[model samples]
Target: MTERKYAIYDSETSGPRPRYDQIFQLAGILTDDSFAQVDQLNIRARRLPYVLPGPKALEVTNIDPYSLDSPEHYSPYEFAVEVHETFQRWAPAVFLGYNSIDFDEEIVRQMFWSNLLHPYITNTKGSMRADLLIMMRAYSACQPGAFVIPKNDEGKDSFRLEHIAPANGFENMQAHDALGDIYATAFMAKVCQQASPELWEHLLKLCQPRGCDEILSAPTCKLVTHFGVSETHLVTRLASNPTNPKQVCVFDLSVDPTPYLNLSARQIAERMRTDFRILRTVKTNSQPVLFHEGDKLAPEVTAEVTSGESNARLMAINDHPTFKIRVAEALSIRASEFEAAPHLEAKIYDGFPSRDDERLMREFHEAASWPQRKDIVARLQDSRMKQLGVRILMSEAPQVFDPAYRDKVKRGMLENRLMPPAEADLPWETFASARAGLAQVDDPELRARIETWLDEQEAAAQAVLAA
Candidate 1:
């Protein structure tokens, strides 16, 4: 059997929105097949030129702006190069991170896109990605009482890393720090694996692309998976798609589709306009694991999916052949429409480029030094490709170029509208929203401190306006 290498990583970012936010700190802990520690990476990258750090995010991560400009820190371009190389070394390994699918993965994808590297590099090249948060939830369901459940200030069960880490015997000091979180996540994975080897093995298998395809393509009556914290172990059924098995639609079997089935096609369309979860689709490649109909599940897990009336409704729907066919048809139509309209952001972050573009990008990424890359890029005739090359070169190693070259690169970026325009009002709009959220803070002292920070930010903005 091949060695089962794994890379557990974490990133602390500038803000919540991945589109504009940039990662300032990133850390990873690599382990061999047996979960033995092998190598690690911890880096703090300088903030991107156009990105603004969120005040609350900065406070939580304790990322100082002045320190980000220090010699120790890597520029965004340099950081991208280093990260790409690090993952290449650990290529074909499972990329696992806590709540990474929703947040950290987006940050990484955007970083790669902006830096002209493969955005989904972690998932391609025989590699795969998984979210530890989902695994943890699965473990909790599969092996209840295996790990301690910690409550927060409200006395509600909290699954956040800081609380869960100490509960599972992992040191969690500097809880919000990227390196600390990486260590904690790795240790927690070990603990979960030790406690429930079977479930852990299942999760690991699900992390593989081939494994996901097999499981999703299998015959399933009713399956169980999670949507969010509140909707854990949601029962679903597969809706057929002849071509792309990867784009498998899983209907929420627990939801009563019987009421909607009685409606005409027009009424069903209207209902879809309101709430589309009459059926749900699972992109198996992205989210692989789902408990089969007859799989032995813990009582708590069963309770979550097999609810009282919902279970009965699903059984009824299953029994009615006509109902099942109609519901499937409706879901299939919706899935077809969704597939036709690909997300714009996805195009921007696609890992696979054209053969020619890939070859050039690979060459640029593999180039030994900045000057070598500049030389190769300067020879490119394609304006877009040239712009990408110059952008990466300028950002990654600005010190290598003289003032004139730098000016030309900046002008190119401006002409292409790659950089945010000086007069853009989005930042001010964000500031207003942040200020509104600050009013909800009940802690007088903390609120006062946040207000002071906000004032400084406003002054800085005013200075930019004056400039």
Candidate 2:
């Protein structure tokens, strides 16, 4: 059998929201299953024309946006392509990172989606995703003695990579730098693996969809989850979503199973809304931290509910097929309640592109000239793809369009950055918001530099509008 490889990565973005923000730097290190590094990558990109860098993000990363515009750096589209192709080459590997499942991974998907590339590359094509932050939470909850967990000022457990990595003997970690964080994450993963090999092995297996399904299939299991603090819930598989099999609802065995047995789907959903302890939705593909029935749990967690009680509740839940169906119905109802996404970038999950549209995406990337690419963009079947293709052309190759149309596109981009809509909730960073973010920066020198950049941007926007 070929040994599995892990691609541990980190990303530094212009802001928090993946839909509107952009990743300026992405770095990764590929290692064998044992965590021995085999290869590495570090790439930076120039900011897209429409993206105004958030002042707070710049303060954290200390990246000068002007510096990224040098000829040596890749354009945003080219950067996305390079990262996508490199990860594809390293396929069948586990894509692991610190808090990546929520933030970095979303940035990657948006980067691909905005550039007219396939968005689910990390979770598809024989690859899987994992988060070190989740792993640390599980470790701290289940086996606190196995490794050191740093405490914040409030004395609560701190899982930030910067705090925990250094506490576990990883030295000189550059917290927000993409490449530095990758090395720190790899170091911490190795520490966990070495400290408790059996637990590390189990958590690593849970990173796979099949492994999560297998563990949750047991009669009763321990689930380690975190919101602000880590918690271990003794839970049993209630039902898998009828529509999405990957989404499984688990019943907390600590609560008596008798009261919930007769409730209708609506009643159960009401109970779920009032108290999540009744039914928790777990995504099997999201690397949930689950342990088999016989696994050792933390002392306090074991005392929450005895094995006998948990098993009895599990038996009761398993015996009630009608209740399971009702819970599944409730899950569907809750899912349907969400409002439709307001923006094109937010509509990434609307549906998959047709095979023909997918083929056109490939052609768009491989086309010889800007005119050819523009023609291919016009032929795309999906509205999202068609719109995104136009954006790519405008950002990267506007020369193909007539001068008037090109100027119109430029003016529109400038207006979105410099002018705020009448609505208070602006999605992307505008000139006003960016300037406001500058007030929070304490370092005089850095604030001055960013202020100068913002002034230049304002001047440039005026010039384009006047043109």
Candidate 3:
């Protein structure tokens, strides 16, 4: 079967910015290799103490305030811990979402970052990540009418769950709600796969990170990857040195790089910095679809896009003794420059302790009782681990921690700026622009509804200030 085990999930957040927003709801369903549901989770968390809810987001999701304020809801820390434990069971399965690679996945990473859990869990332990929207787009471009394509307000095709679900005959009245979206996404995946198995298989293969290593190491390649709604076919050769395996460097064979080859390494690097098309290098682990010199492509792919001549020329350039060495050297120089900027380094793994410290963390996470977990965290040697531990203790079992320690952890979090900063001038700043935009709206009902929403929001804000 083309279908593989996947855990479809979705998140409803306070706003769009992952770094600044907070996710209040998380819903996931674990499916078998055939995409059959094995387990599920639908958790609503208490609002993060740090973030003010985005009014526009709140209005759209229409989450019940009573449910949010109820004692039954999971605190942010509790939710994080529960999600971590739940995912551990579903792990090593491809993490699937509608358009999660760009949004929901990042929110998961930030949640883990704040909670001191492994942020890159989706990619860790032989697992993979896939997006239904990407495959849907690819299918729409290559094999139109395989599934339903909903039109937007402009009568153009839209991949949004709000439109796609109903168009495809899937119930999605609760569109923005987390669990509702997950069910719709899972059903969409199943429908697409069942309708066109071969295309579905090909797209799923593209999402996996496994095959890229072999493809990137090859002498010549026909790389087929989706950019926007269309796929681009490029004949590329490896350009980076062996030292930089993580960084993929390639020369585009369709366009000649020989003229640029005459330039000095620094000169080539400068041009590359400005125009990426001059020399293309994407990370190998990003799962680009590669077909070496003689490998067959999909039947739907046209010859003009994947011609034999282009592949042969790519082979010639790679085989040229001097070409490989020179490009590798140039890439090494450019990489060194990027490495110098320390702040640019990723902080996703910041809280993850060393291998030795993993044992303590594991014990803390696995302990049956909250007191046992607290004791384990208190005994930890690492400062970061201890800080995380005490904070978790204060959050999970506040009664155990004395008032002094609880206050200290809260103060430390603020002093260190661990909390996400609020966008003080928010909807008002966007509201003015939106009103100006509404001038273009011809639909009287739609315009009236938008204006009403804005007025209601303003009233709510005024009432809060008055209170």
- In the range 137-256, model 1's lDDT, one tens digit per residue, is 877666778788798988877889999888877763568899899888887888888888888877777766566666555444333455544233344454544545455555465466
lDDT of 2 at 269: 81
TM-score rank order: 2, 1, 3
Report the alpha-carbon TM-score of model 1 versus the true structure.
0.77
**lDDT, residue 261, candidate 1:** 53
Candidate 2 lDDT, tens digit per residue, 160-252? Answer: 888988888889889899999999999988888787878777887887779989988887777777888777777888888787888888988
Cα error of candidate 2 at position 397, Å: 0.4
- Write down the TM-score of every candidate: 0.77, 0.94, 0.76
Give the 10-residue window scoring lowest on summed lDDT in candidate 2: 294-303
Which runs of model 1 end up more than 4 angstroms from their true locations? Answer: 218-222, 225-245, 259-278, 297-352, 366-387, 397-467
lDDT of 2: 0.85
Q: What is the lDDT of residue 415 in candidate 3?
A: 28
Which model is ahead, 2 or 3, in terms of lDDT?
A: 2
- Preferred candidate (TM-score higher): 2 or 3: 2
Report residue 308 deviation for candidate 2 (angstroms): 4.9
On the 0 to 100 scale, the lDDT of residue 214 in model 3 is 65
